[model samples]
Target: MNRLFNLVNQQDNRQLLMNTIRNGRVANAYLFHGPEGSGQEGFALEYAAMLNCQSRENQPCGQCPSCHKMKTLEHGNIHLVFPIRTGSLEKNDPPFKNFGPDDMEEIQNCIRKKAENPYEKLCPFDGKHIPINFIREIRRKIYLTAPEPGYKVVIVFDADLMMEPAANAFLKILEEPPDKTLLILTTSNIDAILPTIRSRCQRLHFPALSTTDLGNHLRENGIREDRINLVMRLSGGDVRQAIQLKEADLGRLREMTLEALRMIAIWKIDKVYDLVNRFVTLRKENPDEFDRLMLSISFWFRDAAILKAGKPESDLVHADMQIEIRKFVDYYTELDAFGAYSAVDNCIDLISRNVYINLALVNMFFKIHNRIQPGKSQ
Candidate 1:
């Protein structure tokens, strides 16, 4: 079952789950919570398979009929639930009642991608909430007799997105979870989950993968040897993000960051606005693009700060850009490199929250400059 992805970093979580299977003391429900790209969702799917596997060995042999279905997330007894934009619908209208043909097609595609790689970031149409109708269907299905010989498993991805009605409905299911039925919830934002729900389920925290583990995973994926270190650091211990950086050509993103800094330092409004448009506009269409850019920007300032402290290039994330950083630090002897890092870091958080984008980006100029050239009139 672990073959679906590299969850080696979550060894404790894996052992805990396996011990339950070994001890025949499975919980009625479980919550897999962690940061994005931490393999929470993927692990839920595999655990579901393990519970339903036809083998008597207490683990998925990856060869049974049930295992085959679980591999592609097509099992009859396994219910894969997630948030969707299915507005106002009946309480028992079945899953995806409001979805049209196109929507269904898109969802199937996203599911296939997820089945292939659970960490693959996907959004069919920016799903904002889980409908209560889906919850009713889950309640209905679990109370019925088993359609198959394995335990009924229902997995809800991003369970935090459930609205009030849906959340309450799910709480009831958790309160009296059916026998031979397991419901697993995976969420990146566990704080958003209702504490009532949290108290009922066994909570498992999935920590970020170590750089060494991420590096190994990237190597297996054929990421360039030279880019492995940079990708590992930039991914913040996320394997999916590491792949995204590798595919997006992280070197180009670094160049973009350096260019923006050069333009911002001179306070050229026309050119800066042009660059900002390129950044903000693309960010709306491709968030990973903007994420790469911003993370790269932060690294530039981090390198500058490291250089300012007279540290070795070995300590820099973008050590290859040492020459450019050295000159930048030398020219702006008063540059508050630490302040500059905080500025971009804060901007990243703002943009993620959907704050005023244009102003927020433009302000970075004054903010970074003020740090370097304090008390100077713009």
Candidate 2:
């Protein structure tokens, strides 16, 4: 298979870009908008290589010098930008003003990781923004002619992290980009980008990967069959997240989720409160673990809904716990099961938006409790 096509499953998108390349009508600026891990950056790199490849074929010939340079992200003509912190600090610490040596090392490490695995999420510099100074640097670099006399490609990963000043500064270049320069801005959250910048770029919307694609990728990466099935169901087509969850303490998370569900199912209000308090404590001490717990709970309800709908057991995310799921389903009508799922979904949303953890989980428990009771209409 061609190296570029192997990076993504969106054949139509590949064909569109190939046609543009063959026709010599490639756009000056493009916005590759999609969920993280959908291979936006990989596609951008392959597209860059294709644009500059000195091959008879239109696709990037892996044998070409340009293609080899692109593989390591060392092509002089291609520039890369992504979110970086200004100072050395723990991830939860407040942002600092000056870029330090440690910060530079961290940024380089992230870049190297991306070169190795395009689907990997970069280490986050929480509470930091892509500063205006980086935009100015990009502005200076974009105007310079490509050393090799081909296209000058600038790829901005996580473009939505740009602060107001940085975004505004970028608009100047977007308005009048240097000849033969291609700017590609990729973002998981397109609404965070400035309207002016968005209007200047040709938008390419990437959909989530299909379950089959995600499963294949996991299997190819040597994930166990059971783990692959669970991760596929929980990931909602997000391969990056599936990889993360595969490394997590999934058994513990499932046990916690089952305990919480048991409390709700048995109408033990006091025990439910205790469970919610435990979750609140976990949120304060280890937020990532708390998130995994919440995700596990959501998946549990999803399986219950599947069982209630008479779906195949093979379709359940918690297929190993089919007996437990079937028992849970017997307590509710299909509508009730759906209502429970929606309640859990709302709780997940609220938690994401920084709602009080105890309140959100406790309310979610009560909602599920109400839905599970016979003769109750949710």
Candidate 3:
């Protein structure tokens, strides 16, 4: 359970942060801003451990008394604020209002697994978003004196989930935290958070991992070489997502995308209708898994385009789908390729808006089908 800052993959960013620690210019409030699964929370936890370690030379010794406690997230001076179920507040519902020890345990498990295997599944849920009651609890604790010899580090993960009231309620503390207090907020949805809160914290953005790095990470994680290309293309340089993709089964979705493309290219209205109906059924029966299907379809066209251009298998975004991509490219026109991309973008936009999943997927099918066959426009 060594600190995440000590991770070999993040040495460069760690060095930059260490320089700030050495200079004694630590800010009261810091924001780790980036997309999900970029290692922001791990970085924050490592820094907190370093800040509280009894024998901090350049980083946390990971062997000291303070380090041991911090590793388990039980350090008195280090606090965690995250979202919890409202049921936790009701005696008949659960324990701890809006947050409890279980929330902490879930996060701890994810962190531990991530540290053990860099390619472990990466997800944005660190036990839900920050609730208003959780904010109140944090305010009460931070308003008091430090519990240890060093700084009081309060790491708030997924800060963007804060409701408007909670965001405003915490603004005052961010502006003027108590002595020896440090606030580190991490989130992928920074825009949803209050501008006032954003302005108060020193922001650090974590970039997406490089494609080569993601591929190498996947290879090391024992992912099958055949599926690595599809995962990398669909992940778009997000290693966390790449790892998740590795855990999914995409054979059926691959078959669906190929047939859907073929139907659209031939201007077969009945076949297109059948495809959408089947997809809608698949989505309804497996609502939680629709996103993977969408991603598979999206990557199919990406690989097809590369195949059409006579690109080598290694040059394809979905190298693993070379055979499938070549099959589509053999019959698909340039117009068909562009149409598929637009459909995917439209589906993403609609999904983000919380639209009905079945309707959105069907609409995307119609849009792509019509683009390929003007005569079948509805």
Candidate 4:
């Protein structure tokens, strides 16, 4: 496939990988580390395709037999290892059943969907941690020799989420990996992963896309000039996210922010509680999405503060929220805006550190409310 195009704005990284492929000096194990939505996983897949493609080009030949199989995720030599939850492992989870053909089909479908559309609907699995059982299965696959003549490649997406048990189990294979094996692990949270596992892999950090690159990709992807700033603000230089913002309705995002801001600005405690209750419900439906929503709110507050201070809109990460931000100016002082920003920042920090979401939400609300007074510093 011409996945080099899918790279969006990561020209430097793409060039680096292309050089490595051209030289046939691929690493035995690679750790692609960066912030989420930076297209690290897509890069890994493209690299894999380039390595495994029979009819080689600067990119993968999508029409070749090997490339066709890989595009469909049916390539025998291209394997995947990821976390699988067994919260209540029974003999009935299908793949969790016998690791059978049907189970493999389901897993392949899930991964293909993820590969094709990482920013679409969340996969129906846990995102916080990769389960241990998946590691054991990976071990089993590693022992099985490649069906093709070249190398057997295993790509583990979201490797940082691997539980301790899985990490330890995989350490054995990493220490003495198969002769023909090539392992690539991609993660946004590299610090959270085990150091032992880190030591076994060649690390590559993926940088965020540049503003010009982001703008170009957005334009290429059919985003309008008027909404480009909105996508840019929400994406934080991540092209995958920019693609998402391009497709979503900003009116709804505006509505959600207005509701939250109304509750905060007016010091309506009960209404705040109701608003948080809505968040709780949203999180229950999709925890990952709830995290994104919280991020959106945080950015809005940050932008509002910047706007209050008479700074450039570009200084704020959520420039797309300006219309809503104008609403806050009439009701909030610069100090009030800063307090809201601080509260949201603290909440984000706590949540990232694995704090309970319910308490985090409530605590942020009260803190923001108490700090709303003009002279307050919290």
Off by over 4 Å in 4: 1-5, 87-95, 98-106, 118-124, 127-136, 139-145, 163-165, 222-227, 230-242, 245-249, 263-336, 343-378
- Report the C-alpha displacement of residue 68, candidate 3, in angstroms: 3.2
Worst 10 residues of 3 by lDDT: 86-95
* Per-residue lDDT of model 2, residues 92-134, tens digit only: 3433236567876776677776777777666555535776777
lDDT of 4 at 272: 78
RMSD of each: 3.7, 5.1, 5.3, 5.2
Off by over 4 Å in 3: 1-12, 87-95, 98-129, 143-148, 255-274, 281-288, 327-378
Native-vs-model 3 lDDT?
Answer: 0.69
| Model 3: residue 119 alpha-carbon error in angstroms | 9.8
The TM-scores, one per candidate, come to: 0.85, 0.82, 0.76, 0.74
lDDT of 1 by residue, 1-378 (tens): 345334546777877888899889999989999988888988898788778877877477788898888888888898877878776665557768778999999999988988888887555688888878879888888899888888999999889998888899999999988889999999999999999999999999998877777878888889876567668777777777777665557767767877888777877778888877888897889877788778777888888899989887777777667788888888787889999899999998887798898888988767986776523333
What value does the lDDT take at residue 377 in candidate 2? 41
Model 3 lDDT, residue 349, Cα = 81
Clashes of 1: 0
Better of 2 and 4 by lDDT: 2
Model 2 has a clash total of: 0
Q: Against the true structure, whose lDDT is highest?
A: 1
Please give the ranking of all candidate structures by TM-score, highest first, separated by commas.
1, 2, 3, 4
Candidate 4 lDDT, 1-49, residue by residue in tens = 2662256656677788878878877778899988777778777777777
